[model samples]
Target: MFVIGLTGGIGSGKSTAGEIFAELGVDVIDTDQIARLLTQSGGAAIPAICGLFGDAYITESGALDRQKMRQLIFSDSAHRQKLERLLHPLILDEVSSHVQRSLSQYVIVVVPLLLETGDYDHLIQRVLVIDCDEQLQVTRTMARSRLSAADVKAIMATQVDRQFRLTKADDIVRNNRDFGHLRAQIVRLHHFYLTLAE
Candidate 1:
């Protein structure tokens, strides 16, 4: 099936865009969601994570201690790489399973780090990037996640720069405006994708 790799920086409205595609009857597989599931209590990745990082990273409820892990990874790139090494393959396998089971004419795999990882290239026919200004990204992320501006900027620093991300997109949706504008672009793209699928 035709696949679109939907990606954008944090707070660039990727989840919103994915929801619009889903509302239009497209299959939307989100890798971040899959990752979350894997790291949650009794998740597939838990045993390995516990073994590798120890029980310190696992909360009393058996879920990942996201805040602690986030701090570690942000402070040390090596820790981030180590965690990615453990999780990326599992996420990819689950994503492939979802794609194969998808019933829609096309699929949108939302990977926030799509361009940075380059692992989903084989699965996507095109790239759809949600674009917004850096300030918007910082503000939106801070507002939604309750992360301080420094924390938001730190996450943004890990992602590919805006211009680089835009340059790689096969299609772009500028999401700095209101929901109506964002939805209008998504509606237009929805129809265009339908034609492409046919």
Candidate 2:
């Protein structure tokens, strides 16, 4: 099975492209989703996070306080690295198990920090990058998450820049236009990825 790394800068519409690929029946594993799952009640990473960040990081329902945790990690590089240390290994292992169980002809694993993480590289056969304008990213993220301009820009800074991501891509889907144009890019990329698999 082929593993493709689907990545993009924050608010670059990675989810939109990922969904389109999913509709085309390519197995898609979203790392952000797995990260969220890890913090949910009864998840593998919850205990370690609680132990490190303390019990206060968890809610009465036994869920990680994601907003609080986000602030903690983003503010402190040491804290962020510590969290990644505890979580990345378990995440990769579980993802591998998931892919093994599914036995896909090809799989798309979407990672927002695919470059920054350095946890995966040679593991993926291809790198698919979703491209767009920086100002557009600010606009879309602000519209969706209602984050302050400073906060959005900070998040963008944490990941690899757009040009660097494009430089590393085996494929690129440009998303600097309307929904219809975005959809067309996805349609074409879907066929392209499938053909490579064959």
Candidate 3:
């Protein structure tokens, strides 16, 4: 199956774009969704995470303490890499299975760190980035996630910067405007992708 790696910085509307693609009959497998499943109580990654990061990183409810882990990883690159090492292979396996089973014309694998990870390079046939200005990313993220502006900025700091992300894109969707404009762009891309899938 043709797989487009859909990625963008936090609050860049990657999920919103994935929803639009789903509505248009495309199979959208999001890595973020997969990660959430892995971190849920009794999830597959729980044992490994607890072993590597210790019990304190695991909540009393037995799930990963996401906020705590996030803070830890942001300040400690080694922990971030260790966490990624534990999770990436599992996520990749799940994504591969989904792609093999998919019946759509194509699939979009929404991987927020597509560029950062580099492991999915051979898996994706194309790269599609949903982009907006950095300031707008902060505003949108803060509003949606209820995170402090400083918190949002910290997350943004870890992602590939805007210029680098745009440079790597096979296609870019500018999402700073209204919903109608966003939809219009998706519609155009839908046709383009359909033709490519042929």
Candidate 4:
């Protein structure tokens, strides 16, 4: 299937963009959702994560303690890399399976770290980045995740800067406005992608 890799930094509204595409009948696969599944109770990655990061990172319910893990990764670059090394392959495998079985005209793979990781380069035919102002990103994320402005800034720091992400996009969706504006843009792209899929 032709794959459109949708990416944006935290709080850039990529999830909303993906949902818009999904409403237009496009199949959407989100790596973040897959990652969460893999770290849930009795999940595939729990054993490896426990062995690598120790048991403290695992909740009593046998799921990943995301807050603890997030703090660790943000504090130590090496630990971040280690976590990626463990999760990336598994996530990619699941993504591939979903793409193969999908019946939609084209698949929109929502990968927030598409540029930062570069693992989906060969799998995607087009890169669609959801763009927005940096301050807006920080504000949206702080509200949604209850993170302090500084903590949100720290997460933003780990992602590719806005300018760089824009440069890497094959298509860009400006998301600095209201939902109606975003839906209109997505509706336009839906038609564009349908033609490409043919």
What digit string (tens of lDDT, one per residue) describes model 2 on residues 67-150? 888788788889988998998888888778777776557888998888888788757888888889999899999999988888
Decreasing TM-score order of the candidates? 4, 1, 3, 2
Instruction: State in Å the error of residue 76, model 4.
Output: 0.5
- Give the per-residue lDDT digits (tens) of candidate 4, residues 60-138: 9999999999999999999999999999999999999999999999999999899999899889999999999999999
Cα lDDT of all candidates, in order? Answer: 0.94, 0.85, 0.94, 0.95
Among the numbered candidates, top lDDT falls to: 4
Per model, how many backbone clashes are there?
Answer: 0, 0, 0, 0
Deviating ranges (above 4 Å) for candidate 2: none
Candidate 4 regions exceeding 4 Å error are: none
TM-score to true structure, per model: 0.99, 0.95, 0.98, 0.99
Model 2: lDDT of residue 78: 93
Model 2: lDDT of residue 48 = 88
TM-score of 4: 0.99
Enumerate residue pairs that collide in model 4. Answer: none
lDDT of model 1 at position 89: 95
lDDT of 1 by residue, 6-123 (tens): 9999999999999999999999999989999999999999999999899999999999999999999999999999999999999999999999999999999999999998899899
